[model samples]
Target: MKFTTLLFPAVVLGAACPYGTYAPEEPTDTRGVCPMLNTLANHGYLPRNGRNINENQTVQALYDALNLTPDFGRFLFKAGRLSNPMPNATTFSLDDLNRHDLFEHDGSLSRQDAYFGQWSRFNQTVWNWTTQYYTSDLLDVQIVANSRAQRHTRSNLTNPMYSLSEVGYLFSVAENAAILSILGDKVTQTCPKKFADYLFTNEQLPFAVGWKKSALPITIQDLVTTFLAIQSATSFPPPPPDDSSVDIFN
Candidate 1:
């Protein structure tokens, strides 16, 4: 039988966010850093791959870890930092990476996948101003994280492929921007077209028979083209001074 998973469809997306009081506090003081680390202590997620991070008091020591936002942390955790975020979105559930089938309930994603996955997750997932993991996806990211997940400064995603998660996140960002723009909201200037192209090409790129293809709901090109059109509308292209001054046949 052909096998395909209904991984993270809209129905699943509609599920209530499992977030509890985990509603992270504002990134003010680093006093409760240990508590954050403790959150993963019993899980042994730290000090792996020869980079030993003290599970107890290290997160707090990072007082200089500027821009330490909660969503950022969640991004890391899901992608395989703090922990492999959707470690097994491929196999089991997207709820918990640790519980994912990507690895043993015993741990995170497998090594081969981790190697590639982490590379993409760090560099691309966060949408850095310059660098990008051009043709990667979440599963691609999990490939690397499953292998070499750690708290090392270098381990931070530095891969050079584009990930679908990055594309999806960009779509969400664009959608949010479009909503704000409709309501006359101030929007940031960010061109994710390159990112969209990167992900699209990768999604449509051929893979070996044994490898998994991208998880897009449709063909890669169509999806990319559709989103590009949507996002392009959000770009701050100069409009004619007045609608009356515009021509429909331009």
Candidate 2:
């Protein structure tokens, strides 16, 4: 049954966004830890209510909005599904993804650590700290990677309950990779810093900044290539060897 999911087709190039428009406003609906996911819900790519999102909705939302391949989109949905507690659940609400450390992790570039008690809210000061490394209008792989590494290191040192498992670390790096691949030129491995700023702060796509979905579908391989680049460039101290706690939320 699961194999049939691979048959889902990618969105056609230049296709109109079927999810309506990218409208940013204060959300009264359930939201999640990931800014990009919340932005998708806000833009109506996912249900604005952010509830009961099925695999089809998730895959289509990703493909239509970000030009991601359906397979890659499905992989993300499956990962989020790990957070849902319902037995044999095939759907998930955005809030269900709030379960820590599935993909959401500590040392977020924008959100506060879970220990701070407002882990889900976007903190402007934290965002400012992360963006300080982006001195220019453009952000390259190394810049993004280093910024993430620095944030992780800081969190490890200051947050008394800090914890990041291998899974958390990988997801953190992948989040950066997603931003670079979706907003910047995949070949050049760079994107306009303003585009990222608008997305992270306002929870909106930076269409006004001349950002458009990639012409070529963003494959898993595209993300993998960027992920590897960021990972290789990142230089941060390892967590304590005895740090066995697995749960984390940013």
Candidate 3:
């Protein structure tokens, strides 16, 4: 799963805003476990209130802000919708996405396991472990892969209740893929560690750091290929499913 070397002259880069401007403000309303989604809300790509967000709103926001293809955005939103407890609901608030084993899962890059509770907020201790691997300004796929595998290892040893289903594992891999796709340089195949930190710690896009939306759209195939690259760099047992009967995601 090697990516071909791509060389494109760096385009003049600045803050890429789908909304009027990239002014990130504290959300006066609820936020989700996803740092990217929360960042989108903070930047006014989605409703600042983070409430009653429907599929169309989410899909459009992803497209406008990150240049994610509409179909890929819809795929992500479909997984997110599963977290909502409401049956037959097409809309979900950011808070609704906190449901464990659905969209949010254990061994997050910056978040703690659900067993510890308060899992939505940033955890510095967990983050510190990951930061050690950010040895350079640019985080390549292998570096990102190592960081993710290390986090999973730490959680496996520390969190007694830590569990990740097959689906959860796939989502976990895709998350890192999304980060790289959204914030990394397409020609270089790496993301800025500074930009990654800003997104995780502040839950805001690093517009101040001169990041712009990728000139090309991020497709589902792009994400899937990155997922395979990450998966190859790490190994963990297929975790048993958590004992919860709610299987709405199927």
Candidate 4:
């Protein structure tokens, strides 16, 4: 699918604490992503050990710049990658799991019979806010008043001004993305061509797999911890019926 050229350096850029604290311990070395991204990874929104992006782009330049990254490796990997349970192929969502909705019929929304309706928006929020807060650092970074931040070191409270509901939503959104990817990978064969490339370039899953081959127990644990840490941080949509309003988010 040729994603390198279509890729953005979102993984490398840093995000600002619009409502919370913005004191990062150190700069994330990803050439493309920023500091916020680093926090997300460290906190588990993304796979712990992933790509190191640098720089960013917008407008047509964004497209042009994304096109410059390599996509072939990712595509090749996805086309043949197998699900852990022995599916013939990998799922497109390496991080998400409850993606059964990708093909299910929904009553409220069906812009058409042939199409499944709109693409998922969870990723959009992550991407949008990722771009949004980073470009325009605001002080409204909302970490819920009673959230874990309250228990964390004052210095470690990335942003402590948020109400609990606010932080819960953010935490929910991030956690959903990561878990859904993992779960989604479990159910499918032939990882989505587009996502495989994205993961290969952004999450550095390939590096983790290679580490496993060396048979170093510590490295294997490192790989798991990294992936787990990232997976543990972010979030994706809930399992269907996705009516989380009544179900409550974890």
Say which candidate scores most in lDDT. Answer: 2
Quantify all predictions' global Cα lDDT against the true fold. Answer: 0.27, 0.84, 0.81, 0.26
- lDDT per residue, candidate 3, 1-250, as tens digits? 3232232222211134346354555547888788888888877788777888889999999998889899988988887677778999898888888888876788898888988878987788888889897788888888888888888888889899989898888888888987776677654568999989987888877887877889998888888777777778776567788868877788
Q: Which prediction has more favorable lDDT, 3 or 4?
A: 3
Reference-based TM-score of each model: 0.19, 0.85, 0.83, 0.19
Model 4 TM-score is 0.19
| Per-prediction tally of clashes | 35, 0, 0, 64
**How many backbone overlaps does candidate 3 show?**
0
Is candidate 1 or 2 superior in lDDT?
Answer: 2
Please, what are the lDDT tens digits per residue for candidate 4 over residues 1-250? 5675445354334343221122322343221112223333333333334242212211111122122122322422232132122454332223221222222111101011112234221233324322332222211112111121222222123323312344333333332222222212322211232332233234322223321111111212222333343335433334566564784545
TM accuracy, model 1: 0.19
Alpha carbon lDDT at 136, candidate 4: 22
TM-score top scorer: 2
Model 2, residue 23: distance off in Å is: 3.2
lDDT of 2 by residue, 158-215 (tens): 9998899898888899889987887677788889999999888888888887888889
Query: What lDDT is obtained when candidate 1 is compared to the true structure?
Result: 0.27
Q: What's the true lDDT of residue 51 in model 2?
A: 86
Residue pairs with backbone overlap in model 3: none
